[model samples]
Target: MIRTGDEYRESLNDGRQIWINGERVDDPCNHPQFKPVIDIRARIYDMQHDPETQGAMTYEEQGERFAIGLRLPYEQQDWQDKRDAVDLVMNDIGGVVTRVGDETIGEMWSLWDGKDILNEIDPRFATNIERHIHQCIKDDPFHVSANTDPKGDRSKAPQDQDPDMLVHVVRETDAGIVIRGAKYETAAAYSNQAFLKPTIANWGNDKLSDYALGCIVHMNAPGVKHICRTGFAGRAPEADYPLSNRVDEIDTLMILDDVLVPWEDVLFYQHTRAASFIRTTLHRYSAFPFVQRTLSYADLIIGAALWNVKQTGLDKQQAVQEKLSELAIWREGINAFLTASVATAEKSPNGLLMPNQSLLMSSRVHALTNLPHMMHLARELCGGQICVTPDAATFAAPDTKPWMDKFYSINEEWVADDRRKLLGLARDLLNSDYAGHRLTFQLFAQSPPFAQLAAVYRNFDWQGPLEFSHKAAGLSDNVWGKGTRH
Candidate 1:
């Protein structure tokens, strides 16, 4: 059965051992730092049942209904349906950077593990994957995909790094395997049902026995610890900062100490090649959809920025209009790339349809580069008003209202109190820790951006383009070039 928003909320009471700062949290479902994410995810769950969104979020299969999440079969129609569903959810959220775990990364992890079934791995792995898919359909379990270890140095392998920095197999038993280490910069750890497949990359030959493993474990599994980052959203009084307060409330670090994974939860073990394949496929397929979602996110950001500009009476300024225009262009570019990818999607060898890898990669590249630029444009458009805006409390204060009313008002139409409200929101976007979190999210999402660009170059079929250009030149010989371009 598809879980409703309330059901989803109830499920979060599973007692996961999550820590923020120094103390362990008793109930993240109600905790200020984590509740907003839970609420956002609940709304996504409710969307599956919403009349207008039901068509896009739920589909029928084998005489049963399934949510258009991970359970949606990888087919042309299914892909479109999922795409529509993602856009609908993103649009409702007004493009704030919600944690990625609830749908995007969770579904991607499940799908990536499902790919292994195609390789004819042990029957147990395939069975586990199938069961996981059904569970996702029913509840759309919140999850965090942990692939990056806290590698102490850039020039080192997993084994070369301190063992504590890399999650690895500590012991193998007939029942399951034990692992210990940590995954850094994990988002939404406190609210997720499980952590899926730590580090999907292939461990080189020497490190295969240790690093090359994949599995899913309950968030509250024994010995699991969560450490969250202090962020802008969790600290502020909601009355003073309404919008930013509800977004980005669950970014965290996952620490695993001798965590045991049952045999059924293990997707791949000692199969370095398969691990590499899964990672590549997951990154190629999942990352692109996120890029597509960012189009809608960008739309919201642009709208909010423009709204703030208009509120501040700067909309008429030529300089501000130019920045808004650039923001619009960036959004349009993302939308165009998303449309192109969907239009040209192809089926995988396993008969599951996926976006065109090359085109999607290009989209991700653009998104990674342009997200920061979008934020910069927003900041520039806001100008000095972002900092000058008084807090909500100041507007509400008895003595300050009269003085604030005379000088701080932005336009004749809006009273000083009203203008302060709008400016407070603008301040939330431009001057608060919320703004810092946005920057951090964009950077982390596409961290080491050059590496992603390199991956795109490597994975993309350069021959097709090069051959076309060569043919255009009427050359009999094929020539290729090295290195990636911006």
Candidate 2:
């Protein structure tokens, strides 16, 4: 049931009551701010059906074909296949932020829902999983992972926050449960079909027990509301600002007021312990796939930066060449880790192929450490021209054309307009609100950078390495002791 890009686009025409700012959006499909992101996601759907990418997106199992995404079990080939799929989509969208937009979240939610059924307390959960998966494959619906709660204070639990800050179950019935509160900083909520799993493990506590609820709901459901930020997409014309024109996936704040979730849609409820399990498990599963995406994004940025350097006549300078070399090194480092993780993938007990845990953990840590540095390096290499470049309108202005031509022309190689366009694109990458949003996303996607490093340290097989060192030094014969570290 692989969906085509057109099929995916048509699905969004469903009557979903999504709001931007205070107004109820009558048609999200026609919304200026949301249309570009929808188009970007549609491109991802198109990738699955594309001749070149079909191999990466679909896999054969039991003589039946299925479109594989980041959620597939850890088969040996699955890691690289998923990476290739991610690259195809990211490159088409022109960056990494869109990679997080809707496709990834939908795939992730489908995976978690499927896993919940197989690992369930009730047999009926399996039916729910099957039903959900079928719906996803057929509709290719967009979704947002509403996992982070708005904690009033960093040190306190969800109960300590204003009750409205965390979505929680307020009433239970034989049919379902009613919930109220909000999920903060949710990306692409306006374009999604439903939000999956609002509370992650960190917020679990006795006082916050109801907040541990998990479920899925249609965006148009009663009592559900979405508040979006001022997006770059809606800011200006593409002719004047090319970067923000075609790629703003609006981030949002979602509020639920007595929202009812049917029993069929509830993955977990009042199971606070399961919240932590879900977080750890999802982190283990998603780490490497994300690295694959970020690395691909870095690769594109590196290419663009190098080209900008050449266009600016700075490529011949030793300092500039050295900076480009560093960008290359960073790119290679990310790629190496991605390759290692894929090569080391193993089959999960559920028959899903996933990335190697150790390598995946390392990749996440490396991304936290390296992405900002890499982007900063890109900005440095491109220089002040990225920020000071004139808009397209100014370049086309008759009065400014001659002076603009003389000053921007470099070495009689690239045309003044060409240089202006390149620098404008670079500015979009480095100086625009889009750039700021990307940095924010990179910094907060999983958790705080320190927390990510801690998870890596926690999951790392340090004792195994230590044992190998000891054995090599003839200090010990036992390597089994390392297994108990976790």
Top TM-score model: 1
Write one digit per residue (lDDT tens) for candidate 2, span 360-422. Answer: 777877765787788889998878878877777777889998888888887667888878877
Off by over 4 Å in 1: 62-64, 95-97, 100-123, 154-156, 185-188, 198-207, 311-314, 410-412, 472-486
Collision count of model 2: 7
Residue pairs in steric clash, candidate 2?
73-352, 73-353, 73-354, 74-352, 74-353, 74-354, 75-353
Give per-candidate clash totals. Answer: 0, 7
Candidate 1: worst 10 consecutive residues by lDDT?
Answer: 477-486
> Global lDDT of each model?
0.67, 0.67
Q: Summing lDDT over every window of 10 consecutive residues in candidate 2, give the lowest-scoring window.
A: 101-110
TM-score of 1: 0.88
lDDT, residue 222, model 1: 82
